[model samples]
Target: MLIASSRPLAAAFDLALVDLDGVAYRGPEPIDHAASSLMAARASGMQLLFVTNNASREPESVATQLSTLGIPAEPDEVMTAAQAAAAVLTRRLAPGARVLVVGGAGLLTAVRAAGFEVVGSAEDKPEAVVQGFAPELGWRELAEAAYAVQRGAWHVVSNLDLTLPNERGLAPGNGSLVAVVRAATGVTPVSAGKPEPTMFTLGAQRAGAHRPLVIGDRLDTDLAGARAAGYPGLHVFTGVSSARDAVLATPDERPSFLGADLRALLVAHRAPERSGDGWWVCGAAAARVVDGRLDLRPEGDRTTTLDLVRAACGAAWEAVDTGSALDPGSIPDLAVHEA
Candidate 1:
């Protein structure tokens, strides 16, 4: 089981490596309580680093968008997967080496900043290929990456996220795009984003934080990545994941802390307790399996909806890990409307 902290995360950790999209905002709209809680966290002496898997834009552009969303940010405070990919590539290639750029200007700029010459095609005899995502990414760019990788240029992909949220809906992410090149070239590129520790390490390094908390909305990328990086991460119910997902999360993907929003950072975490045949949380909700069916019920003292969420997750994770059946119908209404 993940341990709880005595103090709130904002005060317990020196820095927070926050993921964008679902955590801070959805498309162009800012998430509820994200701005004010973050502002409070900063005032309480916690450093903030906006870590994004979207490499389509540069750091300055990302920071600008955050400011527009009411979250204060600066270029140096943002970390991009593109930068992580370039750092890995730079360590292997010689300075001024020719690197074929396959995605957006961000990837090119990062590679160039790392002292490499950015090229556009295999005809340039590039030494390596760096790829990311951009709306304008075309078949021509992917073809260039395939040709370069097939010709033996070392390949690197900034991220492997299969989907990214846009104004319309879910769209193919850089991971999905990278698959095309991989299929054509019969080669795989080294990934530098979530589920890999490189980006988190770089963010912590930049913030000079020895104990940094990873804050995100997705379990697969953010929470899973934090576990892979050997750091504790907090789960905010403002994005793709819900309390139900948390209850069914694999052992490795479980988050250390659960919060309704960024505001939870200001309050200390209270862990659930193991009761007779189940788990109880916040003295309001309890969960247990009876007759091969999961049973979640409220006690006399009712608390906030998050208490039930916490109880359900604690019992569900325990049951799953213990080889118990968790039928869908067995779970009651565990949704919390306030995020």
Candidate 2:
């Protein structure tokens, strides 16, 4: 069930650990309302840390892109999975340990900065292998990773996200490439990105935030990471997951709040209330699952579509939790449509 906050999210939380790829921008373009909403949240005294799973680019590059997209960002305020992976390696390996670098310049930069001797080939007898994502990565790089892993070098990956949202559509993420290496080597690389809690914890610690909110579009990586880090998450509809996905989310993937976009941070959230007649109500929107079918009724014209979505998710989640199997066909298309 979604949690209610009497105060606006920007006021309630000290910092927002925000995901970059799908929530703020997809590839080179900015998502609608993202920049302005984040600016407003900053005005309300909430700090922002752009936490990203995309480990290809360095922090300075990411910050430059965000500034170009109308969101002012500093390099120090951006945390990349590459940085986390480097940190994870530093904890286990000695300084100047030879590391077989896979992926792109970002991974190389982080490893070098962490006092690791970066090597290009498995024949170097590197102490470990560090892999991240890069658009140009192909068979040659993956093969090197596989070889190193098979030779008993420690394996560490930036993230395990299977798909990355780009301007065209979802593309194979680092996780897909990691899977290729794992298949050949028969060894699972240690993940240091989302769903592991490292990035979120690092962001919160840097921001000095006691009450941090994780905001992202993906349920599996973003929301799941938030749960593992002992923080609440806010899922927005601007990316991969949809309203239908939210209703069917597993217990660990559920968010504390739902919104159409980053703009929701400026408003208060009201949780759906379960009525005596088995209906879940949010404002004037009501929904229920009866005989495996979800029924949604907007009681009045004033009912917002997002509230209707909230109500539906509440009803569906309750039904699923109580041993009632919902018909997948019964779930309505609750995607937010822009005029």
Candidate 3:
């Protein structure tokens, strides 16, 4: 831990590269304190840069939704995977190059803005196939993409998120659709979304941030991408991952800081310190795995639940670093106590 922040995270980092779905909002609903936290961060002079894998909506649309939710954002402040995938094409294909768009209007607009001619079918002999998430996508679209890839055309997918969250529930994401084309054409697309560090770098550069901290809810994509880009990541439990997921994460998947929501930015983040035999966090809790059983020592005067939670996480992660985590039965103990 880097000397544990005495001040809030809003003052600790110059910018925050945030994820969309899980971090900011779960579909149309806002995560608790997400908007207010972002507003406070911005008020403290920290820049907000939204990095998202959802490619169906345009950046302007995403910003509009954020504004509606009380966190005002501009179109340029949002970076979509479509723009990142389009960047890959700009680096390869020349101007006027035809690329078959297998997603929605956002993707088509990106390719066209990148000086490429958008096509719908392989009959156009597109030089590449760019795929993304769109609700209207079906078997015909996947078949068209497969045909383009089979004809020796390059394939690029905005993201490979298998499940997409919405107002209803988790639905088939672009990754599932990409799998269809992959199975048919036996070709995997070059990914340009989270877990691929390139987009994070681009997002920070766009925001002109010197030291940016990535805040999100997913370990595989948001946290992993931050690590891949040589940046520190803070995990918030507003979506996708749980406390069990964090403590049990592999070396590459571990997060630097953990919190319940975006509001963690407004307070000090004190990482647990080492103690004898196990680890101590917040001076109120001690946890260790003894003979494959997780032992929790709740000290006197446990003031904040978040502090206890942090301590448990620190000890849990320390244990997992050397050995395995305790059984699944102990997972609930680490999970936050909901009211």
Candidate 4:
């Protein structure tokens, strides 16, 4: 299911819309080889835009964090869901519209920067409500958003990610917080983040990119966003999604390229080929699915485990696409642990 690229990805794509937390860093710590790999891609003339669904932090703050992680970046090179949500509000509401701010400084700053007056409570008769994620958020913010939404105010949210990866583990994301308001108000807010394509489209437009690649760890957000934006997606196994997930990805969530990590950008990607005996082969790795069970083998020569993953995914995807049942248990364990 993967696409072939004779040239290295850094050379093939003019700009890379890269995900932040899971792809580059796990939290306060950096992922292995992420700094070096990204630096190499930049050296190869591929511009990088750090795109994040976490809308709590501003671009300058994010850039500072990346710099501390050894990935030098400019504020302009970062795109946040806050910005996309602001853009969404700007297009729908008139200038100087009163908006109830339900998140932190980032969401407040974006809404204000978009020329909307920020209000704290629904009593202000806010014209709309925009929400994002903030560690300090509590029932008060959710209640305010709910009241505004119930009063027929337009509702916009930065993202709908239920979970967020952090230094400790998975925590509630903006979507989980948004759920509280949705339940109370009976209104589903318009999402302006990943899996919707606005963030990726804005990144490519800002970069002036003719050929942009979306690279990230989560398939649902990053890869799905790419599909929605009509861009190629490269899935890396360094984060939440695993090899098994890739092998079982649905049509809307499948990625165009697979890699162990960001290092995949520096190398050529080989597309899996269908062999005569119905096995899918990539380099020396061959994979086949028989009776809903997956079978993997190393053929003539030694091959990287990632190639085997590609081949396996190809075989499994083809089988699933052709109306054949696939057992999730048949998917191999090819986990790449984060350091």
Candidate 5:
């Protein structure tokens, strides 16, 4: 039996179901300090699972992307809405049950991997119909899904996100597809993502976490998922969410901790200082302080800071490297300082 916490934000829960796209990365660029934040959480002995509502990509692919972005992750560390949908069908249907999949390869792969037989055509007459976001969705596919549902096949959908963000802008998401299927069949498919408990349960079980902290940038999915899973979450403003959104969010959709970016959060957690002009190491990043200047640098990135103390330290280090006497006035202002 799952127990609900009276003070959910403060309560130390056993697992975290973190979203990927809008939470950790936006397009191909990793959100600022995303790698460090995960490293910090892992260092604190928190189990982490990367959960996503995007059913377009498989878990292995998602893991590969995370690894390329300098984050240590494996295929098993990732969870997608398609996986949740597959679990639902696998638990409800008999092994080798025929399933009509109308989505991307991710959904199809998960369904087949779960021991379900995929039907190529409506004439195949599946026992279940699974729907997700498919850019190639045509009228024929919609009609086929509707027809399958009408024939008493169980219906399942990956997520209900009305729009998915991309570098171009918001585009039609799984929710739009769900609406089409619902209008045609008059059947609301079971949602398997975000604000749904099944994804969190599966994530926690796989991660084997006793206490976790959810982190994300979207209020609707990541924050909602954390609340539904009864875990505390940290919200970063570097993605889809804004400071205004955080202030106006409902209790369930609001995060327990808020930060401008992932780096700011790590700085606050590790080297919190009031008055100082020195360098402080936080995870793999080194924050330096020079004569009224500050600089921040991650392991592989150039060192720069906005804080005066960190800037001074960086300047002194540069002087030492060139075998020149440290002159505070001669040090140039760090170019990478940002609020």
Candidate 6:
């Protein structure tokens, strides 16, 4: 492993597996400082890989989306739940094994490309039933999957995430699909995505790194996945999770490190100060020290001093999104003195 003197803990890690939707970008917009944080990590000699449980898109398409958001990434650096499911099946089952696929084209393509013979219909009584996110899933598909699984075929699912974040809001994801099949077949599927060791193992193998860090916004998937893989994780609050959630997280779902945003975490590795007298601001929200206490402003407001601090934090985070360094000027009316 490459070693650095000042940041020993950071240097110990050689690889980073980050989440896409909630951690880096939400819907079409990239999270503030998402790109810069990744670029900084890359410069620090950490190999970056985007591991996502969203099985809706292909790897190349995911790469393109990241690039469009000003994030420098490659297809090889992206691994989706669909790809993981395919890898598991390819390694375990024989070549050209007849399989029933109940999901979108991404899962079907991955499985087929991995040498599995995918059957649209279960008429052939396939050797396996692979389930993933299918927006148009109907009763017929569920029945077929149950039939195939009941026949002794291996049951596999891309992920168990109950929902996925989109522009409109959270929507039913692969986990919901797996639930339907499970209810029908009375069998639990082998999960191949986040919180499952399969994806982490596959990603680490591909990146060829001994020590890897998992970064994301959600504690359940990203942090849980890292825990399952025995790796450290950096939790950012730019997505689904809030500071309140962190405070109340169960032992297994808590993150190793928590940050307001990716850039802020990279700048300082200190844990958030939590005391009865202190005010708590989640992520990039605004806060000001008054009477030995912090008064935090709500998100998307820029009128008060707290709002200004929030805006400053937002600007600094935006700079990171564009792969730039954090500038003190980005946060207005704040004095910075070297300790």
Candidate 6 whole-model C-alpha lDDT, 0 to 1: 0.70
Candidate 1 Cα lDDT to native: 0.85
Query: What's model 3's lDDT at 247?
Result: 64
- Candidate 5: where are CA atoms >4 Å away? 1-16, 264-339
**Candidate 2: lDDT over CA atoms?**
0.92
> Which one wins by lDDT: 2 or 5?
2
lDDT (CA) per prediction? 0.85, 0.92, 0.83, 0.91, 0.70, 0.70
- Model 3, range 1-339, lDDT digits (tens) per residue? 312678788898999999989889989998888899899999999999999998888999999999999999999999999999999898889999999999888898888899999988999999999999999998898899999899999999999989887778889998999999999999878999888897899998888888899988888888888889988898888788887677666677778887888988888777777677565656466666666666666656443365566666666666666766467567553555421
Top lDDT: which candidate number? 2
Tens digits of per-residue lDDT for model 2 on 1-339? Answer: 799999999999999999998899988999999999999999999999999998899999999999999999999889999999999998899998999989888888999999999999999999999999999999999999899899999999999999999999999999999999999999988999998899999889898999999999999999999999999999998999987899888889999999989989999998999999999999889999999999988757543377888898899999989999899898877876421
User: Per-residue lDDT for 248-319 in model 1, tens only?
Assistant: 788888998888888878888766778765555544676776666767777564543666667777777777
TM-score of 4: 0.97
Indicate the worst ten consecutive residues by lDDT in candidate 3: 330-339
The total number of steric clashes, by the backbone 3 Å criterion, in model 4 comes to: 0
Count clashes in each candidate, considering only residues at least 3 apart in sequence or on different chains.
Answer: 0, 0, 0, 0, 21, 1
Collision pairs in model 2: none
Candidate 2 Cα deviation (angstroms), residue 145? 0.8
lDDT of 5 by residue, 1-339 (tens): 012233332234444466777667887878777787666655655566888888878888999998888778888888999999999897789999999999999999999999999996668989989888878888889889988888888899889998888767778888998898899888878989887767877888787776666778788888778888876666666667665455335556756555555543343332223234445543355544444343445556544433332323333444345455544444444333343
Model 6 residue 115 lDDT? Answer: 91
| Candidate 3: regions farther than 4 A off | 1-3, 299-304, 323-326, 337-339
* Candidate 4, residue 250: how far the Cα is off, in Å: 0.7
TM-score for each prediction?
A: 0.94, 0.97, 0.93, 0.97, 0.72, 0.76
Candidate 4 C-alpha lDDT tens digits along 188-274: 899999999999999999999999999989999999999999999999988888878998999999999988889999999998999
